[model samples]
Every structure is written in C-alpha cells, then in structure tokens.
Target: MNSARCILSENDCKIFQTITDEWHNSINIEECFLTWESKSKCKAQSKTSFLHTLCFHIRGLGLRWGEVLLLTLNGKFDVITLLETGKFCKSTITNAFPDYNIFYQKGGNPHGGVLILIKQYIRVSRIQRDV
Candidate 1:
C-alpha cells in the first residue's frame, strides 16, 4: 500500500486534502493528471486577458448538487453549465444557487435539463428565441 500512495508536493497535498469526501471518492487519484494540468492552464490563462469557464455534464444533479457545488466553489469558475439536471422546475435550480443567476431550458424528456449559472458580478442578458 505504501508504494501505491501518490507522491504529491506539500502544497498539492494540502489542496488534495481540501477536496470534499464525495469528490474524493468519485475521482481516482491516478486519473487526475488532467485536473492538475487544468489548474496550471487556468493560472496561465488568468495572467493573460482570457476568460475562464467551467462546464460539466453531471448526468443528474438531484443528489449530487453538493459535490458539484464544492468543485464549482473551489474552482472559482466565471460560468458554470450543467446538463441532465433532472430538474423540472426553475425554483429547484434557483434554490441550489441563490447567489448565482440561473437560466435553464427544460426538455420534454424526463430527467433531461440544461442549466447555466453565472456569478452575480458578471452581467448577462436573456435572449428570447422563437421555438
């Protein structure tokens, strides 16, 4: 088991320790190289005049909102988009993120929904489309 332990820097260990139990269990440590690389990419992008966005296809957010919120807050993303929310009403989505401006389009199929969450500081306008 000792040999299987992941070798991480002190700071990386600290960051890893901060991950929520749900996320920790859901993600395998060995498969997370992309996550670390994305962090570096985000840092590099931040130095430039580029905008950062975090998008996820959760499949279902009914029982996994906590885990998703943990990642979103920790990532400090400018925008968050979620798919397959399994939410039929707008109130449910609004209640999840009171601080965010939520826009969603519910599909006719059960357990199918799309949501976009934008932070309060960012200005956004709703565009009406003729369907």
Candidate 2:
C-alpha cells in the first residue's frame, strides 16, 4: 500500500526518538509544525522539495495513537502511510485524526490493513491503480 517508499537512515532513528521525546513536553498545535527534522539530512534543501511523507509499519494503531500523534507532529509529516495496521475495518477509523483526511483498505487477513493519511490542506483526488 505504501508505494512511495523512503527508507529511514540510521541518523533518522536518533532524530525520530529525539523528536518523539521532545513532543511530549511541547504544546500541540494544529497549524504550523516545527521543521527541526528538515534541518537534518532528512529533508532535501532544494526548492523543488515535495511533501514530507513517511511509511511506518505500525502493527496496530489502536493503543498507540498518542505516540503516533506525537511522532507525526514532531516530524512534521505532510503525509503518512501506516502499513500492517491490524484488524481495522474501513470507515471505522474516520475522523480519527482531526487535521488529516483518512483513506484505508482492509485485507482479508485479520492482521493486515493499509491506512493512508493526507493533510487536510493538501488537495488530493483519489485515483485507482491496477496493482
């Protein structure tokens, strides 16, 4: 489900942890996220830079929503693809994330699903793929 796959580097692991830890102490804001990660190698300095996207294989997004929220907020992700989200039905998770629009595809298996989140400000139209 995560077609736009970008591998996280070793340093990204450190930054991810740091951001997650720091988010706990910071106030939550709906608009304008801190781009601390952008200063690192994580972001491309070019003006042609695209949206910040991350594909995370969180086994279950149910219990760890707070953590997910913190990470996404601190990382300043514009789009996120949650892979292997277990046992969630389509439309059951709508409005789960207030600022982001949700799109999901459930699989036959009890423990496999795909959840895509795009920021509300990003104008996106769904397109079908032959895959």
Q: Give the C-alpha miss distance for residue 44 in model 1, angstroms.
A: 14
lDDT of 1 at 91: 77
List runs of model 2 lying over 4 Å from the truth: 1-47, 88-96, 128-131
lDDT of 1 by residue, 1-131 (tens): 22223687666666566554435664676546566677789999888864568788887787677778688768867688888877645776677667789888886666688888888888998899998
Q: Which ten residues in a row have the lowest lDDT in candidate 2?
A: 29-38
TM-score of each: 0.54, 0.51
Candidate 1 segments whose C-alpha is farther than 4 A from its true place: 1-47, 88-96
Whole-structure CA lDDT of model 2: 0.70
Compute the lDDT of residue 42 as modeled in candidate 2.
52
For residues 1-131, write the lDDT of model 2, one tens digit per residue: 12212456667766666666666655663211454544443545554557899888787877556766678768977899988787654454565567788878886576578889898999987887987
> How far out, in Å, is residue 16 in model 2?
49
- The lDDT values for all models are 0.73, 0.70
RMSD of each: 18.5, 19.5
